[model samples]
Target: MAEVTTSPRTWSPAAAPPHAPHSGGPRWRVVVGSYGFRLTLVVLLALAAAVGILTYGNPAAPGSSGFWVIVRSRFASVGTILVVAFCQGVATVVFHTVTNNRILTPSILGFDALYRVIQTALVFLFGAGTLAATDGLGKIALQSLLMVGFASLLYGWLFTGTKANLHLLLLVGVVLGMGFGSLSTFMQRLLTPSEFDILSARLFGNISASDASYLPWGALVCVVVGTVLWRRRHVLDVVALGRETATSLGVRHQREVLLTLVLVAVLISVSTSMVGPMTFFGFVVAMLTYQVVGDSRHTRTLPMVAAVACATLLGAYFVLRHVFYAAGLVSVIIELAGGLVFLVHLLRKGLR
Candidate 1:
């Protein structure tokens, strides 16, 4: 009787197998079934439309050298738009994730205002000629470093304590941003008309103003920081669980928050340096991403946010440039639309 052992159990084809780790399906199919696949597809379609409108019907024959030249020229603007979209999209999403705030963007940390202050100060102190003499890439590097350093120091001081309060941090940031803005305004008022005009161009976020030379550096920073964030997606999920929960789960909550905020600062610096200040674009993109993806996980939401941002930027550029022939107005229109969306969101939600 003791030797009468049970036979090993076997799974039948009709019965589900024992639980095993998911290896994920085919790449294309997985992407197709993703939460924001339709939004991504729409963005791709809009990008194609934008490229077509920009490159088609050149005075040069379709296959001629001149045609290719025109296409290359058009691509510069498109490239800038895409870069700006990626930077803003990823930065804002990560920012909201780390801060656990839906209404706040990386820009709210005062990077944009700092950028404006930098520009205004440059013009006010050294004159427009000196400002114009500064190289584009050099300016980007300097501004990015300044912003990153400021954010690192701020986060280090404010969050690396046992009694850290995010609300206090945000409130302080808002006050600093307002102070910077007021100083910038005061400086601008004292400038000559010519100097103010030049500074004004630099203050407004404009895709056309992006220097092609800065693209390589901007793309490099974005790719490196983005890859780091992707690698830490699981960690981000844990962090989003709130500081106390994350700590109980063995996450270094303060350290992770500091690191995340530093990266956010870097991304915002690159975007602002490349294309000037975009106050509400990131807010709109992140909000739309949350709505479209319906997921809190960074892995699911980040790409969708990027796609929505790209679509918004490219579609707006195409309509403004080709349809209305007001390419210069693209940033203004975006800010206006984003502001309206922000207002609506606030009105609907009523501060939770």
Candidate 2:
């Protein structure tokens, strides 16, 4: 009888919460609206225009031999420069995104270091004159591929848990670079005065002397890799969201990361092969792109911004090469400027 007494319970539908109001503008819109972003675009475009003028020439005209030669000579260097810009820019941006940091670059991965060591070994073993007399294109390609293989092996090991901490990977890279530097120094110390001159010439870049013969092959490689990046632009943007999130979104993070590293290696090989290694050049360009873009959207920011930044840097170098360095080294000047920028960045970050 006591169980017969039941309490009345109300049946009610679940209430929906209020929808949030629309934000004033999209993130992209806000980013594009910033004055700094506009200034960056203006400056980059101006620099690109200047580079175009510097590179362009009337080859058919009489007394235009030197001008036309510069024009023709830029074929591979132009492609190499653009490829390096885009690859390094995109690579650095993606790298920073993956690691969630802004200051790192492909150089930190030891790709460039490995490249240096390979070049040094080639000279030390085969002698510098041999490399110079040999087919430069074939030699550059061989060295590039070797560097690529080394980078792939390094990445495979690191990503596959060979290294527990990413920092450890960077530390290893730094140590490897130091080792390479030491080896190069020891080799340089042993060279006779004549041998030293030969080696030193092989060790730096001369845009005017850039062999145009390599243009076709370098262009093909850069086009293929650049196309791959462009086609997978969305995937790159997703990868920038970090591994777990990118994986959750159906982006194959590991595969993409490895592919990116390969692409970066290819770009590095092209640039270094064309002009030797220019330390902090990519760092300056990538940092400028980021500061200009104000967001990490690879679709719009990575390649274009990087190209503009590099064109600008190269244009400045072109002018300075003709002006202050008439007979001096362009690489030395670029390295000097880039080094200063690096120092400034370090100081600013340190202060912060």
Candidate 3:
């Protein structure tokens, strides 16, 4: 037995064992260790796919000048792929963030329909020959600017009005898409078969159809805009908490939404102008990004989303172009697969 004079030991809070388990133990480790490994793997896969596109299926000797020429030509396509993926991934993810809905994509805004209208109008009013005439940097610039301006005007007006709400904004966008699509259909009906044929090819979201000249401008714009978006990631995370919560948390919800929408317009416009119109491509990439990264944090997801997009598009390009000998069918396959996935997701959760 202990001596009577011995002081009894007390287990105070300060005296608690340091090695005891914690519910929040090393969370950063989980975040960093798991996400870092996955991100690194994805990035490596994307690099491999890009390299395969550059090196595979060349007829010339590996070190020959002719081999480099083929690689350079393929480089143009790969560059286009990067720009498109970067734009779509970033835009769709940001769009999801501001809207507080992962199910929605930027395509709902009638960007594709507007692009089709612009294309159909070119062939309808100016004739098929004018399509070729409009292939310069100027045409692409004008298209992007017009689309951005339209979106800015629409967003600025709707969000500032007394009745401002996402539902009304969405309703207007849907109505506009329908109207534009109708206008395009009516015009397409008037074109001769040959003119329609020429118009048809331009309307599909064909990465190969991108002009090499557009790559630099696209890349420049992507860098500038991407930086701006990245800087706002924290605000976006707040924004994702819904309008009421964001506003309660001192985040100007409407202002942020308007600004985010404008930026998204710039990205979608650039991508649409470059590769015609990609209705479901962004949706697919964004979906894959969410699945692979398994987190909603914008800081982690933004860059990761772009990397995932690059891998997906590059892999599709490599497979179809090399194995199937059907490079032109990339858009078709993506749309089909994306549509099915979209349906399954929609049905599984129903619309939020």
lDDT leader: 3
For all candidates, what are the clash counts? 0, 0, 0
Q: Rate the local accuracy (lDDT) of all candidates.
A: 0.85, 0.68, 0.89
Which digits, one per residue and each the tens of the lDDT, describe model 1 over residues 22-121?
Answer: 3354566778867657776867776786676567557998878989888887777888888889889888888888888888877778998899899999
Give the candidate number with the greatest TM-score. Answer: 3
Tell me the spans in candidate 3 whose CA falls farther than 4 Å from its real position: 1-33
lDDT of 3 at 125: 89
The residue-level lDDT of candidate 1 at 266 comes to 87
Per-residue CA lDDT of candidate 2, range 1-352, in tens? 5667778876544443333233435666877887557756655765664456355444556447887666655555555455455555556666666666777777776666666666666677878767667757778888788878877777777778533445666677778778777878887787678777776766765554567677677668767877887788888888877777998999878778777767877887777777677666677777777766667677666555666556655675556555565423766676687788888988999999
Any idea what lDDT model 2 has? 0.68
Ranking by TM-score: 3, 1, 2
Candidates' RMSD to native? 5.9, 10.2, 4.9
